[model samples]
Target: MDIANQAALVTGGASGLGAATARRLAAAGANVAILDRDAAQAKRMAGEIDGLAYACDVADAASAEQAVAQAAAAQGPARILVNCAGIGPAARIVGREGPMPLADFEAVIRINLIGTFNLLRLAAAAMIATEPQGPDGERGVIINTASVAAYEGQIGQAAYAASKGGIVALTIQAARELAARGVRVMTIAPGIMATPMLLGLPEQVQQSLGDSVPFPKRLGHPQEYADLVVSILTNPLLNGETIRLDGALRMPPR
Candidate 1:
């Protein structure tokens, strides 16, 4: 399907992978709408990319619905929805402080897994009405974000991994259910990417982390993730699959 002139929405578009994907979609001639909690930064990126920006909390159904509605109001129904709004705060199920706070685990699952579901549900509702495009009758495509932690979850990644694992489970089922609507669902499970969270760490710590990746010997660039987004959006055959963006980095149990 041609992305040129199509409407696209990217959640968590203020920074990190979401921001990169937004810029890439804009460059591909898509009319992009960026949704993020950071209104100022999202607005700034929107100005730079000539796209629309909305302040949104993906965990809240009402917030996401309103935000998606705002995007559709500005630029018809979005043909592409990329869910990148999530949090990854690591905590052990049982720690020196005793059991991890229930809130901590809930927060990760709420924002990471539930958040993806919120936006996708609303976006797909609107997209199902969109006139089919291309020979495949493609109405829309949804690309969900997961993490390598889902597979080789480190010691403190129980919450994050569970949330991501749910995303992986949802991909194929969502694709099956939405097949008749001409909507494709897919996921990307990235390894150790040099996201803002990691970049905020000490320089030596960052280097040590990068050295852990087997082949590339470095953390993934945001642009590389963005490139894959472009490929998945344009390729009609790719659906109901979780592509690991990790550079063969099967994490050690730390």
Candidate 2:
């Protein structure tokens, strides 16, 4: 699917990975729409990229539905949907504070896992209805963001890891189900990327984290993730797979 001029939707596009992706897609000639909870930031990014912006809470069915509909109204139905909006506050299931609040765990699951599914289902339905493109009759592509923590969750990442794990598990199943509709589903499980949250740490701490990577010895760039998204969109054969953009880093259980 040559996404040039095609409608694309990116959640959490205000900053970090999603912002990078929006810029990359726009640069590649895609008509991009950014959906985020931060209305002001979303507006700012949209203005920068000349794309549409919608205030959306990805976890809410009504909010996501309204935002997707509005985006389609402005830019046509989205043929490219990327789920990048998520949270990752670390907490132990049982700690000195006693078992982590059930609400905390539920919140992560809601915002990360269920939120991803909300947008995915809406976007996939819209994609399925759109006229297929290219010789393969491809209708659309969806790329989701997960984390290496899903595979090797550390001591205090129970909620965050479980949320990402759900996304990882959903990848193949979604791909298999959407394949017949000419929709491809894939996932990127990043490791220690230089996202804003990570970059906010002290310099020495950041350096130490980067040094843990097996090679390159640096944090993954958000642009790299965007590049992979472009690769997945253009390649016809890649589907039902989760690619780790971790530079060969298999995390230890901290």
Candidate 3:
């Protein structure tokens, strides 16, 4: 769909991939909204993009609902929704500490999988209410972020991988269900990228991670992910799919 002048909502827009997406959408003439748990950062990013900001915990139903409503109040219902809120704490299912705390697993799932679903449902409802645009009867598009670990989870990534795996699994099902409503659903499973979480590691560790990619031999850029989002939105044929943003890298089990 044409992004110009359309309202776009991005979760976790304070930093990393979501932040990049917000900036790109704004540049493309979309009125953007940044929803994040970090209120200060969200506001800061919004200011940079001339967009709306909302303090939101994507995992919380009430918080997400309120944020979405507020965004719609300010910028009309969103024609684009990008779900980038998630956690990636690594822990073994059965480590020396004994089985990983059930709470740990639940936390990852809650923030990643359930959180994604929360915003998706709210945005989709609003999209369905909007008049369809273009000959394809397009209402809106939803883009979700997953991780390469969902397909090849390494040691100590049980919780993170499972949450992302759930997102990957949801892509086609959501797209197929929402198709009749003119809302498209898609997921991007990114390989190791220069996200703040990954960038915080030791220099050599970062280098090692970059070298592991099969081509380009470096970390993926958030902008590249945003670029793919643009591609998906504009290309009417792209739907109900999970595209790997990896550099042809199938990770080895660690």
Candidate 4:
């Protein structure tokens, strides 16, 4: 679907890949709404892009519902919903510190897996209510963010990997269910991107991680991920699959 003049909602748009996607969508003439727990950062980014900023905890039903409603009120029902709000807390089931707390694992699942489904359901419902835009009767597109950890998780990433893996599974099923309604669903499993978390590591460590990539030999730029999102939005045929953006690097156990 053409992005121009359409409404789009990007979760976790305050920073990292979500921020880049928000800017790209806005530049393409979409009315963008940034949803993030960081209200100040969301406001700042929204100002830069001339979009709306909504403080939202995507895991909470009430918060997400309110944010989505507010966004629709400001722009229109979002035809493009991007789920990028997630957490990455590394922990093993059992460690020298003892078995991981059940709450810790549940917390990751709540924010990453359930949160994604929450937004998808709410946004798809809104999209379905809107009239179709293109020949495909395409009411909307939903893009989800997963991680390569879902494929090759390191030793300490059980919780993080499980959450992301659930997202990957949800993508195809969602696409299938929403297909009849002309709403597309896709997932992007990012490799090691040059986000704040990786940037916080020492330069040498970061370089070593980059070197692990078979090609490109570098961490992915947020803009690169954003570019793919634009492609997914524009190309209606690219649905029901999780594309890995990892440059062919299969992570080893840490």
Candidate 4 residue pairs in clash (backbone atoms < 3 Å): none
For model 3, give the 10-residue run with minimal summed lDDT: 84-93
Model 2 residue runs over 4 Å out of place are: none
TM-score for predicted model 3 compared with the true structure:
0.99
What TM-score would every model get versus the actual structure? 0.98, 0.99, 0.99, 0.99
TM-score quality measure for candidate 1: 0.98
| TM-score, cand. 2 vs. native | 0.99
Q: Rate the local accuracy (lDDT) of all candidates.
A: 0.93, 0.95, 0.95, 0.95
**lDDT accuracy of residue 52 in candidate 3:** 96
RMSD (Å) of each candidate, 1 decimal: 0.7, 0.6, 0.7, 0.7
lDDT of 2 by residue, 140-250 (tens): 999999999989999999999999999999999999999999999999999998889999999999999999999989999999999999999999999999999998998
Distance from true location, Cα of 65 in model 2, Å: 0.2
- The TM-score of predicted model 4 comes to 0.99
Q: Write the per-residue lDDT of candidate 1 for residues 16-114, one digit (tens) a residue.
A: 999999999999999999999999999999999999999999999888989999899999999999999889988889999999999999999999999
Candidates 1 and 4 compared by lDDT, better number: 4
Measured with C-alpha atoms, the lDDT of residue 88 in candidate 1 is 90
